[model samples]
Target: MKLLIIAPEQIPVPPRAGGSVENVIHQITSRLPEGHRVTIVSLRRGYLPRKSVSGPVTNLRVPGGSKKRYLANALRRVKGLAFDLIQIDNRPGFAAAVRNAFPHTPIAVFMHSMTFASPPMTTRRKANADFRHADLIVGNSLSLQRSLMSRFPAHRSKIAYVHLGVDTAQFRPSGKRRRGGYRFLFAGRMIPRKGVPTLLRAFKIARKSVPSIRLSVAGGTGKAAYRAFLRRTARRLNVPVRFKGNLPRKRMPAFYRSGDCFVCPSQEHEAFGLVNVEAMASGLPVIASRNGGIPEIVKDGRNGFLVTRYGKPAAFAARMAELARSPELHRRLSEQARSDAERYFGWQLTAAKLMELYAERLKTASAGRRTK
Candidate 1:
């Protein structure tokens, strides 16, 4: 198949930034069949208005002035190239644009997550428009699909769940185990939604009960005030928190290896907790809030623990304490977590599933054209 992928911006096959969406696009494009031709149409630069990506990509840089230029680019491709499918991984704005560009061409929109819960009016409108126009809609988790259904009931049949896969080879656990108590790790951006502050509070509570326990907080937005607040909170609470700001993706294995457990304290609707899966892949048992699709991956108390209520630092702390005291339980959960990730979240299996969906959609499109 000649696949044309229109991303929000130019990202390398294995993305270093842009969060999980970048990771998903990288995985699919990198693992696509060799015979297939893959072309990426994206913004020249994320912030600047450029013409093309420098790397090895078939770049059609938006001319200038408006996102409408993106529509013009898609129209040019539809008329100029013989593409089998177009996969869009961004907002509905792109989807509506593509539909206008190639009305007959089969377009599939990949929904990495939903924004309805906290969506702006424009976003919601575009999401609904994409639902009406796209031939197929792929959701990263059941939670995303359910949220879509509640908002756009008419497009219920169009939504399909495709769980995101993790790279076990890269994210697999390190064998080195440090002596003394468990070292807890928090990776991800230091944003409010991520609940970094909540994690700090929980860590403070946990430190009171377990003094030997160590904490590492990774990632940052360079929010100076926010960073200062966190540091001051740690000092006031007397918590031994190491604010090791932003580690590179390649070095993540080392960070994961250094920790005994991984915690994601996100308080909002997380479409899919990719971090949870990555932690499980690394053989570190996960402890995350039961919000969003986290429960879908973790079998609470089996592979990891799940905190239900939001803002419950005491409950979060207590769970950490339980895992810390129970060595046998920790061992069992860690082994099981790795096994589960290997069995279900491997890239090969994920690629195969994606191919199956692509093939099915292609066949349907072909049949519909013949019938008409």
Candidate 2:
């Protein structure tokens, strides 16, 4: 079957960025059946074209067309193209534009994140309406699925849940090694919603008790003032937290390997905990919040301990301190974390499941056409 994939912008086919959406796209394309023609319509030039990461397929770069020129580009290709299905990776008006381009083709949308709900109420309604147009909708996590269903109940039957998978092969269990100090790692954007402040406070409390502890934060400071506030808070609280600002993706595995444990203290708005998954894959126990899709990934006390949503510096600190002291608990959780990641979050499993969903959607679309 010929497939047309519409994306907001060019994403590397096994994406070097290590983002969940990019991983999903890479996995799906790689696992598609043989003899299937897959033409990727990416908006920008960051990704290379004609590179085969997966199967025998052709990836076409769209060269970043404007809304004004969308119809022109689509019209030019629509005449000669024999696309059996159209699949979109994001919203942001890209899917709507593709729908306009190929009105009759069956289009399935992959909702990587809840972009509509994240925005203000005024714009959210409009975004929700646009999403309702897709024939099939895929959510990366159950939390995301619930959020989407709450807004648009009519399409609940059409929605499917396909959790994001990690590269377990790259991130696997290597027996616990003693690192320099009781190292604590946090990797993600240094933003408010990520609950960096909560992690900071907990680290501060932990450091007061465990004097030899060290905290390393990696990721771009998304909000400048928030970044400053965190630094100031660390100074005032007397916490030894080192901000390793924005390390490259290639360096992440080494960073995770070096750290003793990983913490993702997001207050809320975390649809799925990709950072935690990476840490788990790297054979480290996670100290994550019990909110959003975090609980889905982490089995509290089994794989890792899940702290309450709100900040309790003493409690959070105590947990960290305990982990520091009890190498056995750390080792157990680390083993379990890696085991869970391998059992549930493999790219091969992700690719196979996605193909199943696509096949089911195609079958449904074919049946509907026959009935008409």
Candidate 3:
């Protein structure tokens, strides 16, 4: 089957910068069943050709502009291309427009987040209309699926959830064990939602018990003020912290291996924390807040502990200290974490599930047409 995927305008297909949605799209397209043709439409830098082939996927680049304009221009450009199915990644407006432009094709709107949670009334209305018309809607996690259902109960029949997958080959465990002092790692955008300040306080408290405990914070800095606040808090509390600037996706495995434990203290409801899977794949015990889809992946006390009492530095600190002190516990969790990742979260599994869904949709569409 020929597939055309419309990605968000911010990121390209084979994501150079870190984009979870783009990365997933790339993985699904690259791993699709043999003989299936795939084309991706996304934004491009200045003056590049409008269309080109990148590796096995055909990329159509729309000039950077307003979301509405990008969608309009892209629809006009792809009017001539034929496809059996159209997959839209995360843009409600784009999904609505594409449904109108190609009414007969099977369209699936893949939801990556709770995008309509806090938007204005007008935007919410538009999103509702878009979602209502889509033939299928898939969320990355059950948490996100529930949120969507709560907002649009009428669409629940069409909504389903699929867990995002990680590249196990790139994130497999190193045979080396944790040496020297205990190390903790936090990777993601340094934003308020990420709970960096809370992480700092927790790390400082953990250091009181384990003086040799150190933290390595890595990811893009979202806000300069928040970055400054984190630094000041670390210094004021005398926590030994190292700020590793945003590392590329290729270098993430080394970053995960360099630490003994992984912590994600996100205060916001994450759709799915891809980093959690990557760290698990790297064989590091993870400690994350029990919010959103995090619980679906972390499996509290099995692979790692999930801190339910969020925003409490003491609770987070206790978990960190426990992992640092118990090498036996750490070893057990590490082995289980790697096992879980390999068994459940590989890109191949994700692609195979998607292929099955696509084939089912195509078959159903064919049957409906024959009945008519």
Q: Which candidate is the best by TM-score?
A: 3
TM-score for each prediction? 0.89, 0.89, 0.94
Q: List model 1 lDDT by residue over 1-372, tens digit each.
A: 777777654443344654557677767666665566667665444554334443333445443345576556545754667677888885666776677666777888887767532366256655676667788887788888788778777888777777887888888878866786789999887778898788888887887888788888888775888878888988888888888887767777777888999998988888888888888999999989898888889889889999997578887899898888889999999999999999988777776777678889899889888999
Clashing pairs in 3: none
Q: RMSD per prediction, one decimal?
A: 3.3, 2.9, 1.9
Model 2: lDDT equals 0.74
Q: How well does model 1 score by local distance difference test?
A: 0.76
**Which 10-residue window of candidate 2 scores lowest in summed lDDT?**
44-53
Scanning candidate 3 in windows of ten residues, the lowest lDDT window is 115-124
Report the C-alpha lDDT of model 3 over 1-372, residue by residue, as the tens digit: 788889887776667768878888988777776777888888876545667775667878876578888788778879977889998898766776898899888898888887643375246666778786688888888899898888888788878888888888889888886687999999998878889889999998888898888899998875788788888988998778999988877788999989999999999898899999999999998999999999999999899999998789999999999999999999999999999999998888888787777788789779989999
- lDDT tens digits, residue span 225-262, model 2: 88789889889888788888778677778788878889
Better of 2 and 3 by TM-score: 3
Badly placed stretches (over 4 Å) of model 3 are 46-56, 116-122
